[model samples]
Target chain A: MPTRILKKSWFIKSIFFTSAFIILLIGGITYRNIDDLSKSSELLTQTYRLNVELEQIFSHLKDAETGQRGFLITNDPLYLEPYDAGRENINYSFAELKELSRNNPTLQKNLKDLNVLIDERMDYFQKAFRFSAVGNYNDQNFKENFYKGKKLMDTIRLKIKGMIKSQNDLLKKTQHTYESNLKVTPIFLYMVLLFSLVLMFFAYNKIIRDLKEIKASNEQLEIFKESANQSQIISQHGNWIWDIDTNTFKYSDNLYRLLGEEPQSFESTVENFMKFVHPEDAEKLSREIEKMITNKDLPFVYYRIIQKNGTIRHFKGYGKLHESSDGGKKLLGTITDITDEIDNLRILEDRNLELERNNRELSAFNYVASHDLQEPLRKIQTFLSRLEDKESSKLSEVGLTYIDRIKNASTRMRLLIDDLLQFSRTNRADNVFEVSDINELLESAKQDLAEIISEEDAIINSDKFPKINVIPFQIQQLFLNLISNSLKYKSKDRIPEIHITYSKIKASDDPEILKPKKPYYHKIIFTDNGIGFDNEYAEKIFVLFNRLHNKDEYSGTGIGLSICKKIIENHQGFIFANGKPLVGATFTVYLPIT
Target chain B: MQEDYINIILADDDEDDRLFFTDAFDELRITTNVKTFNDGVYLMDYLNNEESIFPNVLFLDLNMPRKSGLECLKEIKQTDKFKDMAIAIYSTSASEEDIEKTFVMGANIYIKKPNDFKTLKKVLSEVVTINWQYHTNGLNKDNFLLRL
Candidate 1:
């Protein structure tokens, strides 16, 4: 793209150079034409002057001849005066002709020959005049002399006419040459002017085109700068530049606004900007700025600033060195306001501390429930048993009944405590999950209820299970609780038949799994042929201490199913219960197949 | 001392528990000599004496005033004289933590104190009859707790 621009600029430059050269050429041609016209006109003027000198010489010779003829006809001495004056005038004209024809060889030679003919004509006139003074009117010598003078005068006039014709011919030749030059010069100069004008027009068009392009790009740059300023305000950031060579700073207009002042309200210098810095952070910020100047770079620096309205804000800054093509060094920097983030972090830290305290207190409560509360209760039961064994015979029937009632109450209390402890243990954070054999865990659970299984004649069928990742002890307890729940609510007429089935299924296959966190789950379904309740209580059954059956009807602490739910949730799995009155209950547990 | 009868010792802080232990032993038909201490300190003081007779089975109650059953077990297991003696951890609340700790410290078995007098007598007799050499050979975490 830049290369294309460079090529275009080169084209414009060549056009500019071509236009200037054409203009200079026009100026040189016009100057040379003017100089040639002036030289040609000067030659024409010299030729006109030379022709005038030649005509004057001929007129003077005619005057001298006319005077000599009058003297010969009337013997007037006044005529002699005219002849002498004419001779002097002719000599002066001859000198002027010689001076005018000095540079022209052909004209000088013609003038010299004309001078010789004039001199011969004058000699004949003198001879004729001398003969007339001696009164020899009838003498043949005088008559011959006069005739010869006339002939000599004719030759001189002819020579003068020849020189005049030749001089006129030379003048005509000079005029023709000057007229021809004048004729072609206007056309040539007009064509050269027109060509230069065309070159100038092209240069003007290119300049206008380039200026339009520059205007378009400049407008785009202006729009970009405006948007950048708006973005800086929105994002709570500002930009700056520090010229390292001159140690001068340039802050963008938005940078001034970031300091809680109008744009460009203050000079952009370190001292001027430092006035806004929080006193506590000023020293640190100064040290960082100093380092940035020396290193020609700025690492991330955090500081605080108090605005004019007394609102304190946290700022983080970073800079990078920019070296322009002309070898100017500058640091381009950006600073952001991060007060909101720091405040959020502080709130999160406080909340975390409170949560930790609450957790410690909860564990303390668990310890009390496990050890302290059970100690006294165990002693009471032991003493009660002693009473039943040793003093039963002495007591009345009512008193013995009271003893039995007390025993039942204590046993129920112990059951409640033990179940509650089991529930809380499931909530422990440190339970380790391992790859354990599900079959082994199931067998162990059944072994825990071995005597009941035999006495109730419960027929428990199971499917072979693969190794699964789970909390071994907790999963065993889950199996134990579920099986016991079935036995406790067994139908009286038919023996309890518990069917345990296992399969690996996709979470999408189960409609009950809403918003599943995992794709596949280990589905273990425990379907028991027991006295089931209405399906309406399926969800309520898992609630802590929630029971569908009364204590008199079923010996449940209502904590068993709740513990199952908790265990499933700990593994990010799901548990569901479905039941129909007297048909049976199906408890489905889904563990994530990790 | 009679060589044919078994020697048993129990250390518990509760007076009523001590009375129950003696009464159950008195009712049983097994020919045994029983000794009792109120707390671990008195029990340790008597066992540490060189002249005192060591019991074949030592039952240690976990909760006590000066020292606990776990601490006493640690001390007894470290002594060479008590290497062959069977140590049983007997506590009211048989928490998994206590059972695990006592097992690691070389206790032979763990028993939660039974709530009824008959169950207590039954557990004591069963424990007395157990062949320590055979039980120790097959001891594991699963059977470490003496289930009812």
Candidate 2:
């Protein structure tokens, strides 16, 4: 389907067609009027000729009568001569009238009667002249002849008058028709002219409208081109097309701007384009381009380019191979100056490396503090023990008390350091995730605290555990810390009974509990009948070095729960603790079942 | 002449640790003779000497100045002469990497050096009393790391 241009040709075509039709119509009307006028003129000329012939005939008959009357009264030869000339004139008029009315039956009949009358009248005239020449003063037959002549003249006058009246009527009818035809032709012509003018007006209006529309469209196209160029400049993008048949390339002005060159400054050949690429990337780019053109397979290419200003920039170019309408290959593509993006990525990578280094240094510090720091503290305690064992009797009471205090403080320091080590180890541990049997992890955790379990007479009731993908060692440590915490903080009135139960919960079922949103999680709850703190300290207990009870009340460095929290997090899971002052505490761990 | 008595050796760079270790053994009243080396090199030299008797239990400290306990453990396990010697990594560091490495290197046992003298005594007694043949025959990573 062809696209519809803003300027419509159909309007112009319609106008042309209407103009032609109107001109043809006007020509036809003029032609028709001229034809009708000519026909009416012919009819008028025939009527006029017939009327002239009738008038001549009537005049001649009157002259013959007058001449006959004179010749009879005085018996004169001049009168007789007038009668002879009238007779010849009447005969010529009658022949001309007959010839004029030959094609008309009615006119021919009238002329025949008029001719008989004329002949009779001439005979009467002759008789009168002869009778008078015989010298008869008065004759009865002559009077009768004069009476006949008078009557014949009257009859001839009436027939001539009738013919002239009929001719006059025909002329009047033809003239009326010619006048009406002239008036009607002009009115019809004016109507046709008015229609043509209207058609011309409509055609002209449509043509002007189409021209205006075309102008507006051209203006819009100019604005569109400017905006496209502006957008390309802003986005650091430029488009190009490579025509294989012509072996020529068309580059948008922005492409030249991207290369730090004036438009049309550089020749657009493959080798010339490669010259702009960074030396290290040029060969690979050349090979890739060669492969793309040979195989007609275009893939995205990202490389470094050296601009005309000697600045290195990263460019990402991608195009598609297409067959032009003329069976020639063409590649149309866009190139983006991705230097800023590359810089950002490099900065991110550098920051990541720095962060990893910081992490390594921090773990190193933890290991050193855990191990090396213990050496001196252990020495102090050991030598103190030796001093106490070897010289207890010599020491005073205050000295012994001071020594015990020092030992106690050092022991607490050792425990704190050990807990700190455990806390840091969660992050420093191996990151290999495997499918480990939770039952075995729990069993090992139980074995680790077997001595305390038996000594405290703690009853550990646990449900069967499911196997899960996790860092087994970290999970074991997590279990150990929670269980040890329960035993250490057991209620005084009862044997410590810790219930370990776990159930798999879907993310849809327990949205609040599994906050991080995994498909499946093991909600392992460790509910103990041990000394629990206020519920307000539930979140606080998970914080490093956050102790709910006094040191004397709970023998802990307060790092145990924090280590548990870290371990659970390592497995991409969540840990929560709930406690009440006298009631037991429950530590719930959510581990993803993956 | 003294085959019945337990012979224990400790290799440590820290003089106080060596003193404390020997004192702990002395206080325990176990039927044993204890010897101490300042570093791993000295300990290795003493064990290689044909004139010297092989200790029933050898306590190797991981972080010594001359040579690391892991390197010594590797050397001893490779040497046929030290096959009868029961190797124990007694270091203040309880890092899993150290323990695993020492275990893989054929160390008989791993113990984190305790802060209190009583813990040290208890750990040493338990280690010294272990049936070396039986322990070595069934040595596993699980039983290798001995926590005090």
TM-score of each: 0.75, 0.68
- Chain A only TM-scores, each candidate in turn: 0.71, 0.68
**Tens digit of per-residue lDDT, candidate 2, span A475-560:** 89988999999999999999999999888888678855635557878888999988788888889988998887789777799899
For each candidate, report its DockQ versus the true two-chain complex: 0.65, 0.52
Give me the TM-scores of chain B across the candidates.
Answer: 0.97, 0.94
**Shift in Å, residue A77, candidate 1:** 12
- Locate the minimum summed-lDDT window of 10 residues in model 2 chain A: A1-10
Show the colliding residue pairs in model 1: none
Q: Local error of candidate 2 at A50, Å? A: 30
- Model 2 segments more than 4 A misplaced: A1-227, A264-267, A270-275, A283-298, A454-463, A490-501, A506-515, A528-531, B1-8, B24-34, B47-56, B118-129
Which docking class does model 2 fall in? medium
CA lDDT of each candidate?
0.87, 0.83
lDDT (tens digit, per residue) of candidate 1 on A1-594: 333455688777887788788778878877877787787677677767766767777777777777888888888877777688988987887787788777889988887788788888888887887887788878999888877877887787788778778877877787787788779878987887788787778878877887787778778888999999899989888999999889899998877877888988889999998898999999999999999888988999999988899988899999999998679999999999888889999999999999988887887688677667777788889899989888999999999999999998889888888888888778647889899999999999999999999999999999999999999999999999999999999999899999999999998988888888889999999999998889889899999999988798788999999999999898888999999889899999999999
Judging by TM-score against the true structure, name the best candidate: 1
